[model samples]
Target: MDINMKKILLLGMGLSSVFLLSACSWIQPLPGAFNVALLEEKDVTGCTKLGTTTSSVLSHVGLYDRDTAAIKKDLILLAKNEAVNMRGDTIVAISPLQDGRMEFAIYDCVK
Candidate 1:
């Protein structure tokens, strides 16, 4: 292949790989941290409304104070052990906070 063509191909592959890595990070648990279903007060629009993954998980977990507390505790534990990894639900809560956007998901230790 021509030098110009080869350079373009390499650049394209490098860019694509970065994008893929970021996407993969979203699904995978953050290294050395437990995933949490963080429900910010702003996320709830109504009794049935859920604005984000964190909010939804909080809602599904119900509006009980003790339950929420325990959930948080478990989440912390996972993070401490590097075992806090989940996809969506199942473990019901597997989220890691990066930036300001909160995420809610399952602690998919299996993955």
Candidate 2:
């Protein structure tokens, strides 16, 4: 392969890697994790507040930035799994996402 061809091949591989990483999420929901619902704070009235959860994920996979929607979704999934660990059935976002981190309040509204 010529020098130019080798450089192009390396560049193509790097771009492909970035694209794959950006398109995929490393976070996976645990079993029964999705059973926990995300609700608005006002809607959780009368529910017992169990505790708080902080979920974080990689906002950028290397030089490629992940999609904002995907980051938000992953954060929610992690928070839901955490609510399950707390024996809660619902979660409310307590703060805006910042630096790939978010906070949520866990509640048991079904009881």
TM-score, prediction 2? 0.89
Please provide TM-scores, in order, for all candidate models, with all chains considered together.
Answer: 0.30, 0.89
lDDT of each residue in 3-111, candidate 1, tens digit only: 9999999989986765444333223345544333334344332323222244222212122222344344544344333333323212223345332223443333223
Backbone clash pairs for candidate 2 read none
CA RMSD (A), model 2:
1.5
Task: For residue 21, give model 1's deviation from the true position in Å.
Answer: 0.5
Candidate No. with top lDDT: 2
Candidate with top TM-score is: 2
lDDT of 2 by residue, 1-111 (tens): 999999999999999988877767777788888899999999999999999999999988887888888889999999999988889999999999898899999999996
lDDT of 2 at 57: 90
- Regions of candidate 1 where Cα sits further than 4 Å from its true position: 26-111
